[model samples]
Target: MRGPVRWVLWDVKDTLLKVRRSVGEQYCSEASRLGLELPPSQVEAAFKQAYRRQSKLYPNYGTAQGLGGHRWWVAVVKDTFSQCGVKDGATLEKLSYNLYHNFKNAENWEVFPDSERTLRSCTDMGLKLGVVSNFDNRLEGILRACGLLSHFSFLVTSEGAKVAKPDAAIFHQALQRCGDPASSVAHVGDHYVNDYLTARSLGLLGLLLDREGSTLHLDDVPARHRLSSLDELPALLQKRAEGG
Candidate 1:
């Protein structure tokens, strides 16, 4: 189901933008720049493994239970390089930290043409916009780099939310920050269960931003709107806003 879309929350990585070339390419280049002699595949694999473990712990972060994703990412970066024989010194740590930290905001990252066009159209149409993403890096930096920051008045990261996606708390924070109820907000993102189901479960209108999945989800979010591209959003919101 669709409605007036008082607010639209977006996902950052695959939905709004993609990395330039590939992780292998950047890992190799960045590693060489830091004077590391490790192979690209090996360094990239370790880095990825570390990131996964770190991002999984956001829910327990400020409480007595868990460490948040950023610490997880830093540890992963540190260990990955240390295992490759790089010592845990300031230079090595800074190289790993800032290289991965700056990856999203770097000039070479690519935003889908349709994404830029749609975001512009939506903002022009006067719809409130914000971002709710599970990220290690500050999302605002990436949004600013993409020239899309002005479109958003609210942007919440896992750091602020204190939990990652699939946890309704983060989405709730985005909604609260945007000054809307879940019923009037829409969440558009790529992942099936993580983004769509989580939003739908909270009674927010959830749309899966994937070209495939014309079929319904086995769990919740089944029958939710499916958008092949963000290009369709302006029209979808237009219809809802006018009660057409």
Candidate 2:
């Protein structure tokens, strides 16, 4: 039997926050500022290709091979423009640098409508909150800027922990900060495998935030383990606490 939840671990991207604009739109806007004009659709497609290639080549920001997050992201950004026909090395480097820092700003990200309210509700229930994200060091500034930083007691990033989600080690790092047994912690994220299955496997209550019902077809996920929005969170936690 699982104990009452004492901590709520959150996943950052697409869970509590998301980019204000699509990758292609942001990249094109930045490129325009650099005096380069590119179609947003074209840039978006190229970005998808570049991102997949980069992720495949340098998983987890290439930490294992010493690339680190900064270098890894710079490569992805540079490749994205390169694939869109920009070949000037200096221009690529400049654009990559600008884009990297641009994302750190709060203007580039927007909090989910229900994020703050739900976080506050969790706090009111006497639950501690922390972040367990696959993001890099830039996450702290992003969270702080978005006004959600104060809600969390700690943050554990894959870059900081050297282990990304679906790997379990990252969750363990968050657990250490939580100072609670796995049975008394719950993790919420948008990814099914990384957030739900993995957390459940580790004995934590895994709640999948499927806002779009994208996972509705997955029979393995019970209704209790899935949420359509953050607005549903506090009630769910209360139900769990009451053994409903």
Q: Which candidate is the best by lDDT?
A: 2
Hey, what RMSD does candidate 2 come out at? Answer: 1.0
TM-score versus the correct structure, for each prediction: 0.84, 0.97
> Distance from true position, residue 97, model 1, in Å?
3.8
How far is 188's C-alpha from truth in model 2 (Å)? 0.6
RMSD in Å for candidate 1, one decimal?
3.1
TM-score of 2: 0.97
| Candidate 2 segments exceeding 4 Å error | none
- Residues 81-108, candidate 2: write the lDDT tens digits: 9988899999999999999998999999
TM-score of 1: 0.84
| Consecutive 10-residue window with the lowest summed lDDT within model 1 | 55-64
Clashes of each: 0, 0
Once fitted onto the true fold, the runs of candidate 1 whose alpha carbons sit more than 4 angstroms away are 1-3, 55-71, 88-91, 212-224
